[model samples]
Target: MIIPKNIEELASYAEKGKNVFFFTADWCGDCSFIKPQMPEIEADFPQFNFIQVDRDQYIDVAAEWSIFGIPSFVVTNDGEELGRLVNKNRKTKEEISGFLKMVEG
Candidate 1:
């Protein structure tokens, strides 16, 4: 997953191609639970670029996106939002894959 250096870089990613902004924090247990499965998820969906955004580090960015929860996903394609899985809950690989598939179509 690509980690944006700044909000501007993140914006550029959103404008370019299919991108999944994964909002997470180091201290978030839910985030940790899904961290191990991310590699496989990326492999399964090669078309989308996964960008890891630390919620704490990018509080302003998260706020801009209205992401109040950790371990959330915001999908974008060519600068347009496709879908989102925003909530304060634990996510499974299947759930994440389902979200990706839904947005892909």
Candidate 2:
């Protein structure tokens, strides 16, 4: 997974191919809890490129995307939003997988 340094890199990722933007924050408990399980999710879904974006670092971007929750996952391709799994609560691996399935469908 690529950790985008700036908005330009983030845009480039979405503009090129299927990408999943993971919105998180360093202090978010839910984000930290799911961090360990991301590897398995990434391995299970190889078709989409996953990128982590720190909400604190990219406040403007997060705001523009209307991401008010930590550990939000937004799927996009060619700059168009395909689907999203966003909430203020903690997410399980199954829930994440289900969201991907919905997006893929």
Candidate 3:
């Protein structure tokens, strides 16, 4: 997963191929819990480019995307939104994989 330096960089990524913006915060327990499984998730879904967005560092971007959750996901392709799993709940690896499967379809 790559971390965008700014909102513009994130937009550029979204405008290209498949992109999954993972919104998270260092202080968030949920984010930390799922951090280790991110590589596996990315490997499982090779079609999508994962971009890590720090909620604290990119608050403006999160606000624009209406993401108030610590650990959330927004999938986009060619600048169009495909799906999102945005919420303030803890997510498991299976749940995340399931969401990606649905998005892939």
- C-alpha lDDT score of every prediction, in listed order: 0.94, 0.91, 0.93
Most accurate candidate by lDDT? 1
Instruction: Tell how far residue 89 is off in model 3, in angstroms.
Output: 0.4
User: Which ranges in model 1 have alpha carbons more than 4 Å from their true place?
Assistant: none
Candidate 2 deviant stretches above 4 angstroms: none
lDDT of 2: 0.91
What is the C-alpha lDDT profile of model 1 across 1-105, one tens digit per residue?
999998889779979899999999999999999999999999999999999999999898899999998899999989899999999999999999999998899
Clashes of each: 0, 0, 0
Model 3, residue 45: displacement in angstroms? 0.5
Q: What is the TM-score of each candidate against the true structure?
A: 0.96, 0.96, 0.96
